[model samples]
Target: MELNQRKGKVMIEQTLEDALSEVYLQISPNILESFPKFRPPVDLYIYDQAVAQVKKFHRAEARLGTEKQAVVATFARENLLFLLRDDYRVYAEHLSRKLGLVLVEDDFKAREVSEIFFIAFRDRMDVFLSQPKIEPFKELLRDVSILAEYLWTDPCRVEFLTKTLHKEYDLSVHSVNTMFIGLGLFVMASGARPERMEVVNLALGLILHDLGMTNVPKFITDKTQYLVWRDRGSIENHINAGLKKLERLEINDPTVRQCMSQHHERLDGSGYPEGLRADSMSMAGRLCAVADSFSAIIGDRPYHSSKVFNEAAGTLIADKGRYEPALTRLLVGLLKEGFPGCVGEDMN
Candidate 1:
């Protein structure tokens, strides 16, 4: 009878998990605001490992009353928790508050909040890749604006953002990393506050700099052997391909075009497509170049093993004239202060 009861409990738990998966979203309790003037209509659930079941901590209306303290404390103490997916806007607002507070308190909860942001950003990017539509791209631009504002205010959130980078090598993940790291480097190096529009434009450019790579044949990208001129030519053509696609999308921003066109170009005129020298390259182009190179180097590829952050930063710095000296130094500084050391290995 005890064995039967155990089996029945397991089945019930599985059913609960499945049912909740549809209506609820798992959330880190760290971002929950202990008190808010406006609490959204949403139920909160905490999974009790002792009983192996999820239990409602508080109903939607209860959160508006004095029971709020209890709800926050209980959720913060629990390991597994869920919130109504319908109330995501409330959660986003809560995250915004937490992000601002974490910076003031010199707290680590920034990682928790930013990790959620990163996941959502990556999901949006995935949709854009599959659809490649104007709406999705516009939504991505909105995210870029938020990120730029975040960095513009603190500039140090780059450290927390780095911790959230998905070590897995994919176009979406790489693009996101480049955007975050590039914007961080740009903000850090600029000293004086940058215009909001400049930051947004650069952010968008960094994220889409490799958009052309989607047009290349997978076999060429995945090739393990030496590439002939034809193969190299095909790979290098991604710039034009990405630019053409953007043009079709009606994206006429010169900053965006510069990033897509010049990220591969070296300061010493050793790059492809256009062999533009240092004097000809824009700062946005240089910023994207360093960011693209660093993000790619630290991530594993079909052709090469991933380099550690220190090694990758050193490699870029060692290249001397290939990359801009000031930007490489900024990259090094960012790594020294922010890099968590382990990457592409244990990062899940």
Candidate 2:
């Protein structure tokens, strides 16, 4: 499939170069103009075209090699519609069962997988918050490591990845942005002797910090109205549960533990769990706290829509000693500079 725009009109073409050297108009410029408003069923047209083209070119092939071509022809004819509709995921699973070449999304290419994993981690946060299971949490941690390595090695990939998984959910999007922001701060602050492993650990911890809520019921988690005292208590348990789960994983790294454990802890000894003061918290933990809080304030939640970046920054700064003031200022500055588009009021 290829997309090109000519004379201010977009064209999408599908090409099949097997036994049947087939080419088809998957989408015309007219159809492209209606996208995100009126999505036409061009995938069906592509499927029909593939079938007709294959039959026109390779109906008499009978040998083993030809048999393989027939199989490819059949797959293209039968699955083209599904593939175009983002249903390749379903077909890939079916093909995997038969030990065939499972089709993978181009957006999920090796260079893009890290970003996809990051987005998936955020999407799975609701599950993690509700179920708080061990295995899924571990998987989330693995994704964190993957994304960190990708970001550290190829910073440019982050922009491409972010552009690809453009989700409507604000919280999930905010989580990805926060991970980048936090990691950037870590890299910048560490100066000459940046500990790469520590950065990865911090990323994992920051990404999955909300995993403990999986045990909470939906009524409590999704409550739009003010949560009752009991519901609030249950919600608060997520933080402790997240820490306990991390401990069970035997993550002895203090930076990782503190990032998860003290993200909610305030500098004024008013925070939860231990209520540790400024001296008690690790630098990583303090950074995570600022990142998490700032991200959350500017993110759409079940209770309230997201605030503008300036508004969220002001709120964070107002909290003052409750959070790391300097770090909060740095985060606010980063958001302003790096993601001017993020602070807008529009949900999309």
Candidate 3:
């Protein structure tokens, strides 16, 4: 029975890998080069990052205890790779309501080759985060997953991306840049402790703390006029807008809560609707505030030209009481070093 169980696991692993290899091979370098915005599914990325061998990811999963093992299984079932179907008729009939992914008649699926098609999700999690309570948090995880995939293989690009990010200030672009900046700066701020959870949670919170913006009208976000009292009120309301979005979700993670509620606040009792001071603002909030302002300064806006890395760093430093001093120091040092010359995780 043990042997059979092992064989079953291996079979599932091999079958999934075989399908992915076919997809990867079918999407040749030429094909991939054609789509400049193309990003691999998370499964393929994790597999690639774990080791060249297909067996390694499964082994990592297999080694997990029961609780974590179940989580992996849940992830697999809800993964985008598993959701793509030529017909997906049953899915269209049943799952279209529950899922928020791309679904169409096989012919309409991909704008590219009909023979080889793909479908991903703005929110791919069909089951794992389907609960009313679990769904709000999924966007944070989804964005973080995309950022991780981009970082896991192309660490050099992560360092260089801030320059490009300065030219565009879309919400998603800003969030991605913030995740990388905050993760890197937080490591420098904390003296580079090896505790993985600190960086992970910080990355997630920084990326999604602006979730409330999705509800705010684009006109307000894009306005050319100086923000009046009502406009500022609308902007400040986003903090609670974000909190309300996550209120149904049963998140035990305090970082998520702090980021959702406090990203706009300052240390000098001068920020936003609440006017929270240094004592009230949590460490996560303070660190994220620095990253948020840094990215915003570097990012382009209708009102002002984008600042270079040094100029952006100076803006953060000059705003003394608004941000934590030690974090600002680390951030300045990080900008000077240009992120340790693009240090990266080894595949080994």
Model 3, 1-348: lDDT tens per residue? 012222222344666656654433222222212222222222221222123333223221123455644444443433211223332332333322322222222221221211111112222322222332455456545544444443443344344433324246677657766765777666555443324455456666777677777777788888888988887788888888777766745454789778767777899988865889999999998888888888888878777778887888888789878988888887777666655645632211
Q: Model 1: which ten-residue window has the lowest total lDDT?
A: 1-10
Mind giving the per-residue lDDT tens digits that candidate 2 earns over 194-294? 44576577776666666565557877867888889999889888878877777776766777777778888889999877889999988887888877776
Q: Worst ten-residue run, lDDT, model 3? A: 111-120
Write down the RMSD of all candidates, one decimal each: 11.4, 10.5, 13.7
**Pairs in steric clash, model 1:** none
Q: What is the TM-score of each candidate against the true structure?
A: 0.69, 0.58, 0.57
How do all the candidates rank in terms of lDDT, highest first?
A: 1, 3, 2
Give lDDT per model, in order.
0.72, 0.53, 0.53
Clash number for candidate 2: 8
**Tens digit of per-residue lDDT, candidate 1, span 1-348:** 012222322344667766665556554445554335345346776656557656776676553555765655555544355676556545654554333433333222345546656765677778887777899997887767776666667555556676566667888889888887887687677765677788888888988999999888989988999999999999999999999989988998999999999999999999978999999998888888999999999878898888888798899999989999998887787767643332321222
Better of 1 and 3 by lDDT: 1
